[model samples]
Target: MKPKTSALTIAAIAIVLSYLLILAIQQYPTIYRRHVDPNSETEKLPYQTYLATFLLFTFDELVKGNFTGTILKLKELNQTYVPTSLKYIFERFRQLLNELTLKLDDTDSQLDYAEHLIYSGREDDAINPLKVAGYNLAESNITYSQLKSSAEEFTKSFMLPRTQFFQKIDSIQNLIENMYIRLQALLERIEFQKNLEETYLEIQVYPENVWVGSTITVEGKLYTRTQPLTQKNVILYFDGQKISETRTSSNGLFNYTIKVPYTYKPKANIIAKYLPVEDDSNKYKPTTSNTVQISLLYITPKVEAKVLGKPLPGKHFTLEGKVYAERILPYNQIKVSWLTSSITTQLENGTFKLTLKVPETISDGKYILKAEAPPSKIFAPTSTTLYVNVQRIPINLTL
Candidate 1:
């Protein structure tokens, strides 16, 4: 029985020792891996693998035009220690990114310059900038293709499948092609505009001197180098303000009669302009006629006076009259004078009324009463006279 027990105990001890040996064998690899030097060649494989993966992610981000994300990733990658074997690859990527960034900036600047030229009405000058932009985009596209090929080769070296980065490149290429097509179309349009004929406008104003509120004739003709432009619209400007619009007749002549606006200036400027519209906008360039100036005359108010009845001495009497003119007088008062007696009264709606009294000491007689409108900036002074008879109050005497 003791031999049997000893043999069993030896078998149990052998089983425990074998289990401990297997456990130690498994733990030895973990402990060794944990203690491996991070900078050693053995650890370089995983580090390079991580770098390659991160580079692919950054490449994809750049292809997607995620500049902000690409920059952040590039910063992180820069901080990482690159192995000597991959330094040239990183340098190439850095150079490619820098070139692409510069190309993009150049393209943006050219586009801005072209837009500014267009807004400044220099479409002819804008074409060069647009062409430069297109060239820059084309160069960028070539650079992008090179970058894509390099990335594809790097991806394949890692035995990785083609990613959406390739698809993004295709999209960017398509966009660039579309931009080129649009630029070509714009250039064609500019060339067409450059070929369009210039327009000439001739105008004459009748009655060089006119009163305010009076009509004056504005006649003009629109023509090109070869022939007149009939049925075209012509606009007339009075003192820099648009006053009337007319269409050219069969002879390419337009006539517009516009009333002179009431103004305090001594003279006004008249101009005729022809602006192309609809199909004409593509056919002809806009033009303006010579500036014509005309003298502005003020209207003289005609004054007429009448007494309501024979006025008794020392009694009030009504003197009323209508003031006629080409325009209403801005002034509100009219002056009346009668043999050393004078009064100023209000005028309403081109007419005036006044209350006057004859001196009691004056003997009864016939006298001339006058009504006058004082001269103003926009009204000429005028006066009219009326024969007025004055008498004393009748006296009844008791004897």
Candidate 2:
């Protein structure tokens, strides 16, 4: 009886162990879903862990200067539903990142502006933009430090190791520092250049008004701070064309005589420029004198005429005259006209003599005679009038 009872006890113990093993196998899927499955609704990992992990990855991208990737990650994080406990941290991080982006963009924009101004030969104007960039960079540095500190604290709150995160922050900080140093150096160089002496060129032109083919004298001085700059080459430009080049004397005086070209315009501009070269290029800046305007005039011939002894009308009379001008007139004819008769004669050595016959039927009176020189390409038209005594053939019926 004792042996049979012991067997029954062993059999019951075996049956109980089998039932317990089957139950454990049946609950394996639920246990796995709760603790290990990432897609499970009831995940056991805290929400802060996921937030911290995502931030770490985003920071890694930023450290590599992958701004686009960092922005995408940030957008992804922002779109997700955040827990109430981590909402402030996420929002603060976003604000800090936005500020950092703005500051960096502003700094880059200002640097680009400075570069453009420098390339355009406005170095002095570039200084302002460079200064603005410097200010932005400084502010960016401060913001970056705040961002780094916030990230470190947020990660530390979750017991996350921050060695890698701190390294990324340090790298970004080093880049900013390098940029700042380079900008400061460039600013200092520009300021030094601004401190150099300024150069001035002054000019005076003689005989501001002249006819075509005439010469005018251009004189000027090149100096700095009232001190003369001798032996410098001065270039003279007339009507935007390079006409002549001259050198300054011991007293910084430069003189050039250039002939006025035949231009259709009534006025022409002349400018004197001094461009330093070789070693002197660094000592003085290039300068140009104030523009000098020259009045261009055509040669006007003066027609002087006289009637010999005031001849009577309707009779032959001699008209003598000369065409006086600054230049010799071309072999052109002069026209002499009376009330009813006209004659044309060539100018002989700028002088002309004409015989005119008054109308035989005219009454005795004082008449006018006119001599005119036609216009030419270089000479203007001119005319002269003289009064003549006209008598009707001295009619004397008694004689």
Candidate 3:
């Protein structure tokens, strides 16, 4: 049987719990400061110890104490019922991660919007806040079944639970979801602001660009985010492939070098990356450069041929020529031919000698004198064409 709660009873408990949660969150930071303070004495040490002891039980107890406090509240409220143990913590943690994933996704989208608005010179006209409000209403991560289960247990302990278990859980979960949504939105905005503040990309590499299988000097100039006067460290990567490494000078300057090597494969890629670090060398990040593509080619064989010439018809003539390869073939392996009116040649060894009978057709025209080699031989095809006025040449030929 379910009990009914009056408005007055519910309000008192909510106000008390809400106040406690807020106070706990507010005090946790001061508690953290005392412990982390290097120079603090006895008083600070005790507070630090106390805070440490509380967090020793759970990690979340350190961060705004949301998970620990929620667990404690549930334990106290359900004390009369058998408490769920180690198994329950795992279940809740899984559920928390699931809820957080949705929240983080929402945060990412909202951050994108905020970034666009801020950069677009529309700060005054930004609808981010309004849009977030609408988004919160549309998507609350809390489930009614979960709320009902919790509420039924909670209501069983109290005398008057006026609203149904489902409604009560819905209302409280709605409030929690709204706070989570708002927190996520705020964090995203803060990130956007941080990015805006450090807007310039102060990175330089000597020989600013490089070809694949080449090396270039790299230097960096970046202001430290936390330590302004001190220079930051820089690390670089090639698509996460470790490349060159170097540290920036104390004057906010860094220089180093890296090279891309040629691989036996047909193609390869080169990429640049920038990673910045502080005084703490162990703390570093690797950023990627735009990818560069490289390609290679193969070599071909070389060939050359040697050839000879001829004379006109009806002319007293003698001709001689030679055909040879720069790369000497051990055998007489070339084929040669003569073209013209009344032209003939004799091939012996690698040379040709010719005589012309001077036919009537041998006047004023062009003729192709040809010499060719077979496939088994390595010589390229060779030819020469001559324009001749055979009538002007009716009397003479030379060797």
Candidate 4:
């Protein structure tokens, strides 16, 4: 009775251990599924390491004479394990590739055995399995070499280069996309600014009525949105010709003096215009001032001089002249010059008279006298010449 009790107790312990092992096996799939975190690097655990651990655990249980526990451990491995790396999958594929010839031989042996059984008069048993075996052998005729060549060609043509190029293109696509976005924005802004034009310019000329061959002052200011525009070029045009150019000062002031050509038209058109400099931001377009009209005129004068009652040398006489223009008015302070001496006189009623003394060196012969009136502010130059005869004085002496 004592030995039997001890044996039953030992049997009870063994049953408990077997139950615990089965329970652990049932829980493994849940445990593995829950513990694998796809986001974590540790989830890339090497499959070989997992397989070795399972094998070592099974070996330990087998060494302890736990056959049931080992069997349960192997089942858990079969159910819950999955290979992750393409390297491992490709290795297993090669291994299966090596087994193809053995499978074909096995099919051939089955067909031969079926033929033998048919000859032995077991036709019913041979017919079904033989048909299946023959069908499988026909389909599996594709050789290992052919499969390997196809896989290598696919890798060379499609898989390897596609993978490398896709990775490199992923890096460059971000920069290209950013540049495209910025350029699109700039183009949109430029399109909106194509139809705007604005500017402010004012021009003036001193003495709007002018004469030919006379100087006139050109003054102007350039403004943009009520602000002074400095260092800008301004040009003056007269009768459709460029006459003078100047740059604006710090205060946006520009001035030029131009002499009206003598050949200008009766009415002259003058303009002051501004041109934007290169490399400058021309937010406002080039601008021009309003046109200014000026009237042109010419003034010319003439004069004549004569010596009256010049009969003897070293004698006093009268020299007279008249200065007149096309429309004779009171000509005041007309200049009269002769030889190295000059005198100023007024045209009294379009005529002028003055006293003159002939030089004592005169010698009873023909002589010439010239008088000139130089150009003045409003009149051109004029001159005249006169000829006269002088006689030597007779002298008496007593001894």
Candidate 5:
């Protein structure tokens, strides 16, 4: 019985040692992994794996009675040691937060621009900023109601009424400017009417058909609304040049004699101006009378006639001459006459040409050939005579 018991005990002890050896072998890899780097990617495991690892670590701390050390280790693993995937997620979240912050900064800048414009009395210019602000607010992740409410409060409290006030100021300024212009125009019109009603002047020059270098008498009268304007200065202008000046008499009539100057014009523009006497009262303004145009007749025109294309007896000859006046005159109505007979001829550029036939029955002697032109209303009558000698034909072959 002792040998059997010894054999059983030996078997039991052998079984026990073998099991312990197997168990020790199995725990070798786990203990080796636990001593590895703490910050390794495998250390950042899934939630369940981390919980098991944490419980194991906590159990070890309790066995060693390191309560504070276990708490610190747990905290370090949970909070400080972060996995690469979770770090990437946190980095992406930081980037989004930074992007949102930048967008908010942009919105704030736009709001600042709008606020500055509104404060500077440029409400009309704030529309673009406000629109951008609204768009950014819609795009933002923040609540729209607060920002929009603040902007609305600002508009209602200040911007609207301030804009209206500035518009009213501009309207008032424009109104004042228009009123000033209208008042100036009214004063001018009143002055014009007053001048028209208060002062009056009339002029008449005698010998309207006077020739150049002749004397002319200019008579005029000046009168007010009720009485004659006596002793007031009256001046006459011919062709925009001052010619004569005289004072009015008690009858308000004035006269001046002036010699006409040489001119090439067929008409004369005469104007009479009245200058009121200077007085302390600024009631009367200087006045100018109406223009009186007069006909200026020229002196007698000179005529020169010559026979052209040979002046043979009993032959046709051209009589051409130029009729010129002392001044420029219409030569279209000039009439030319030769002796008792008259031939009508058209003048070209103050020149006339006519064909004449010498009488064959006339004796061969010095005969008078005359060219006379009648008055052209502006020019006096003129005549030119030329004597031509005709030779008698020695061979008389007549029936």
Candidate 6:
């Protein structure tokens, strides 16, 4: 009876330790979701295996109370200790992601992103591939003419969901769950350091000017700051005097109306302030916002209209709109030429720098456009015509 009991106990212990050892081994150097071959995004973390190893390492170091083995074993696999430290940082990572999940509520289209957050591991940063692909394609050196067709081909070259975005999240979650015990343990250590000193990134505001009692949007980078910025404290002001204080969340951005006080209307200044980190001693020292001058004499000017792209048979000609208003009137704004034969529609801010594709709607043949602002408006009007030769080839927008 004693021998039988001893054999059973040994078998159970072996099974548990074997699982633990495997988990620890899997995340040795760095786990990756995609293979480490050429012609792909390799920096993307290996979510599932990394999480499994993380959980295993954490349990060994904390719950099992074995630190030396965790350190030594991890060190043998790689020279870096970031992976081992992840064991302690997993919970914080989880919390940050949970907050990210809440951001889905801000937009009706991010329910799947929320789900990805539910089971997301620290290494699983590829939650939104379409966004990733879009950003990548946009940032590429390719021109707008080349982007409308060939750009989409590189979408799958990167991780994240191309179409079934939510499904990608589900897939990532399920893959990690396959080894749930390891994944949970792996999330023990996840730390992020936002070194704001001399950030390589930049944030600049246009017009750098504002007016009292005017609708001045603090436009720059709504998501310019780093992570953990959501829920951070904020303070807005003019000429060093505190005007308003607000908290940022979801988007880590701010764009609100500031009722310019009548007390200081003489060339008022707009400034934004925020506490990026409160836990540290230097956190109370709020970062001053990019300054902008609020003047009462600025007038928005009119824009020139023009046709965009080569019109094809059975395709509508796209028109690009530009508002070249140098001196905009105080409290006066500009609008898009939606009712006219404009190819490019300009944004309200007059920074009309958008590249749009025309759809197949207009009939084949020559099309004319009166692209101009009338005398009543600040802009002078103009007209042009586009000739489409559909007799040669079929309509192919991709071309």
After superposing candidate 3 on the true structure, give the runs of residues whose Cα lies further than 4 Å from its correct spot.
1-138, 142-201, 206-214, 223-229, 235-246, 259-399
lDDT of each: 0.75, 0.76, 0.43, 0.60, 0.60, 0.41
Better model by TM-score, 2 or 3?
Answer: 2
lDDT of 1 by residue, 220-315 (tens): 888988999999988888998988889999879888899888775688999887777899878886677888999998876788878896798887
List the candidate 1 regions with Cα displacement exceeding 4 Å: 1-35, 43-81, 157-161, 197-281, 284-399
Q: What tens digits encode model 6's per-residue C-alpha lDDT throughout 1-399?
A: 999999999999999999999998785543445556533433433354454454344323422323344444444434323333242343333333232222221222332342233222212342353243333333321222232232133223323234542333333233223323322232321112222221111134334444434455554332333443455556666666887776665666555556554432336666665534547313322344566766643333445555566555444544555555455523222333322334434356543433323335544454333433333232233233333233325656873
Q: What is the lDDT of residue 61 in candidate 4?
A: 56
| lDDT-better candidate, 1 vs 2 | 2
Query: What lDDT is obtained when candidate 3 is compared to the true structure?
Result: 0.43
Which residues of candidate 6, in runs, are more than 4 Å off? 1-211, 220-228, 263-266, 280-285, 297-399
TM-score, cand. 1 vs. native: 0.39
The digit string of per-residue lDDT tens for model 2 on 1-399 reads: 999999999999999999999997784432544556555443332466676677678767765656667777777877766546666875787778767766765666777777545432356788888888888888988899889878865566555667866776677787677668767766665555465556778899989988877899998998889699999898898998989999999989988899887664688999887766788755666666889998988977899998885565546777888988988887468998888777789887888887777667777778888899887767777899987877654556884
Between prediction 1 and prediction 5, which has the larger TM-score? 1
Q: Which ten residues in a row have the lowest lDDT in candidate 6?
A: 193-202
- Per-candidate TM vs. native? 0.39, 0.38, 0.26, 0.29, 0.30, 0.22
User: Candidate 6, residue 111: CA error in Å?
Assistant: 51
Deviation of model 1 at 344, angstroms? 66
Q: How do the residues 325-393 of candidate 5 rate in per-residue lDDT, one tens digit apiece? A: 767755664455544576777778778888887776766777677777676554666788887666665
lDDT of 6 at 70: 41
Q: 3 or 5, which is superior by TM-score?
A: 5
Tens digits of lDDT, candidate 4, 1-399: 999999999999999999999997783322334667655432333355454455455545543435456556655654543434444443443333334334444554565665444422234555665666655544444443443444454334323343443333233233234433433443343343243244556888878888888899988888877688888888788887889898889998988889887743467888876655564323545566888988877676777777788557677778887877876543466665544577777667768887766677766776666666656545556678777677875788888
